[model samples]
Target: DANGTTWIYKPREKTAVMSRIPLLPYPMILLEKYERDAELRATGKLLPVPSNQKMNAYLKEIADICNIPKNLTTHVARHTFACLAVEYGMPIDVLAKILGHSNTNMTRHYTKFSEQLIGREMRKMNEQMFSDDVFLLNQ
Candidate 1:
């Protein structure tokens, strides 16, 4: 559905919001197989993959098994991606584009301000403000 060439969804409703995401090299092989299977299935016009409920259930089960204290929802991955991108110093506007958000403000709502990010920003500001004074020795 991306530019009407790269098929975004594979018989599933999961929206491939990001068009230019670079997939891992090995998964390209698997993707080829999936495309072939999809072609054959489409000849008969059968439904594509089943609903996402089962996959989400599996994720929850895995989280429970692993004793993860937090609630394990499918959206957690998206949230984590946003947070990590911000932590790495990607600008809010760029992060918004990568996340397919309509505006930078929307991305801000999703990003959790971590201590590390706050500290890093504060350090940069301090260095810029005090660089000459800190380096100069006062007698």
Candidate 2:
């Protein structure tokens, strides 16, 4: 954030670190909207929500209302972000940095590869090498 960009910081003593990366346009816009709506400029805190357990309980209730089968929690949202980032070809090192991991090895714990992602990467590589004539095994 030293470069005049907005950043989200984790201030807990255990993980007292902040990301150096700048927010992308859409997220930055959302943050601006939240700041204005919540009048958080003075306090610099995003939300005045209750405990994490209470938040998770509310999330579960909302999930049930929405017919989501899986349990909804903060950790699940983080893992979902990691999975989608991997699937979309974000470099591991970049992802690690964005995730506030000291190293890729630590970040690897969050990455769970699926067969579909592997197949997609293989097909993409084949197509890049051989154009439309590329032939790879069925996914």
Candidate 3:
């Protein structure tokens, strides 16, 4: 028996790695699993999981149906997760591991610091260094 949390991600000829998906999408994942099983039962063979290209096409159709103006793709979701995870105080090293990056440098490419974050950090630095309660000592 093993933890049901992770599955290997094999991208073509690249290295396969075990990845954990956040539980926020647990319901959707369960639904997909149910549908996949049903599909297999209905047919002799299982339908392969949709490719990224097909999934993107489906996303575009969904966006059109929902009257969403922006182009929706898997990449957009990954970028959103990268930004939000960093903004929510997840450490860079931790995030790199979560993202399956071999090094922090790969994760850095995915992470973009928002202007709001920059301003917030700057304000924090300013308060810490120059607040009235803080004594500035030249060493």
lDDT of 2 at 81: 89
Model 2 vs. true fold: TM: 0.71
Cα-based lDDT for every prediction = 0.72, 0.79, 0.76
- Candidate 2, backbone clash total: 0
Q: Give the Cα error of residue 9 in candidate 1, in Å.
A: 11
Tens digit per residue, CA lDDT, model 3, 100-119:
88799989888999898888
Can you tell me which runs of candidate 2 are displaced by over 4 Å?
1-13, 37-39, 46-50, 128-139
Considering lDDT, which of the candidate structures 1 and 3 is the better prediction for this target?
A: 3
In order of TM-score, best first, we have 2, 1, 3
lDDT of 1 at 12: 20
Give the lowest summed-lDDT range of ten residues in model 3: 5-14
Predicted model with the maximum lDDT: 2
- Give the per-residue lDDT digits (tens) of candidate 2, residues 17-129: 76565678887777666766545666766655568799889989999999999999977887888888998889889989888888899778888888998999998897787
Minimum summed lDDT over a 10-residue window in model 2 is located at 6-15
State the lDDT of candidate 1 residue by residue for 1-139, as single tens digits: 4543433333223454544544555656666666657665677532344456866787788889999877776678778889998999989988886677667988998899899999999999889868857656575
TM-score winner = 2
